[model samples]
Target: MAFNYEQYLRPGKLPHIWCPGCGHGIVLKGLLRAMDACHLDKDRTAVVSGIGCASRLPGYVDFNTLHTAHGRAAAFATGIKLARPEMTVLVVGGDGDGVAIGGNHFIHACRRNIDMTYVLCNNYIYGMTGGQFSPCTPMGDKASTTPYGNPDPTFDIAKLAIGAGATFVARTTAFHATQIDKLIAEGIRHKGMSVIEVLDDCPTAFGRRNKFRSVVEMMKRFKETAVPAATAAKMSAEELQGKIVTGILHREERPEYCEQYQQVIDRARGA
Candidate 1:
């Protein structure tokens, strides 16, 4: 049977703002499927996003949604988790919004081991904001601001999440459409901070400037370059260059932030 995505989507919100061939819609469907698999009550789930092309996702979903300032999605979601720890809070945004501007908030949230899910949609370049180069852009990619080729180093978001103490971390590309929902559903079920990075394509902004002829070409690259985590482990470091290791990269048990905060309250009452 076909999944009834319409039940989770807002009526009259069709015709999203993403450009033709954009993969954000694919990721959105995966998210909705994950929510359904988890049996999450729409009223109890809060979806938050910052300013960016990916951040506009919450506007189309039927849930408690927050369209916040640029690069502040993690921070805003943290507050929501602290105030109502029982509610399922999810943060969604692009690479630039999550790491460049919201880097501090993102790291702290991970460090605290907050019980929330962060879905980072990485399209390499700043797709909406003038095709600017972002932290995740390839070292030598072309963008509006990097016509001469980007010189900055790229960030490994999954590695960053693991190092910063996220209890659950996973990565999947848009090409692996089926895996997106599975990873997201696992993240939602996890007890601590969960970061799922989705490598999607922005054909209009990132692809054209980088010389990708079409969306299919971009997706082909993902299919060729992605390595499953199990297979990646047996490969040599040299063999793994330029390869993205998808699947759950890291996961560990930890004390969730809200639960720890409640301990403080209990202690204070006893004092």
Candidate 2:
């Protein structure tokens, strides 16, 4: 009862696969803390993930975990939530898996407003599959796929979710560990679909190529660049460039997909 992580951790996988300085472990810790804070039933919870360094989270958690194919976490999570309406389904993955290859699914999931939660670990690069540019990778950043500089525009994940009809959306960073945990806990408690975009770090893949001295330095940069919601509202667009805005971006009431489907079933049976 004292927030025992061992109760929710997988057996025979004591040590994680992430690198020493990787932020994935930090993100995982935040997620576990969130679950504990929410007091979610371990047996009734399902964590679904796609193929990526961060996607390895589902495997380590002791819940009903599913390790799905690349860029398919949202799709798999959707199915899980639809089938098991009683379960608290959560989706976890990296920027590459959630936004790059899984972009379509992500949008559809948001539009459906299913009762679920999505935690996107945005490390800016494809850490597991080599140091490649990801959808959330900042413009002009250097990566193995973008040796010179990335030409594409980066995604504002919280904004996208808001526009796509997600009932709840929040953004936080691994640097703000406690905030991330609280955001995840609140998102999970919300009824409709919620998204928590956690900006993490890939020291090996992203930091080294970008001239960051160390993980601590990168985290410091995150702290400096981050702007709180109240502060961001007072700043102009010009002043907000390169700034990471973190907080609850949006929240609204909506009917969950599965619940609506059940209503239709009830109507048909009555008819």
Q: Could you report the Cα RMSD, in angstroms, for every candidate shown?
A: 0.7, 1.3
In model 2, state the lDDT of residue 75: 97
Model 1, 158-195: lDDT tens digits are 99999999999999999999999999999999999999
Clashes of each: 0, 0
Pull out the clashing pairs in model 2.
none
lDDT of 1 at 123: 97
Local accuracy of candidate 2 as per-residue lDDT tens digits, 132-187: 99888899999999999999998889998999999999998889988988999989
Q: Which candidate number has the best TM-score? A: 1
- In model 1, the runs with Cα more than 4 Å from the true position are none
Query: RMSD to the native, candidate 1?
Result: 0.7
Cα miss at 151, model 2 (Å)? 0.9
What's the lDDT for residue 87 in model 2?
A: 96
In candidate 2, residue 154 scores what lDDT? 87
Instruction: Give the number of the best model, judged by lDDT.
Output: 1
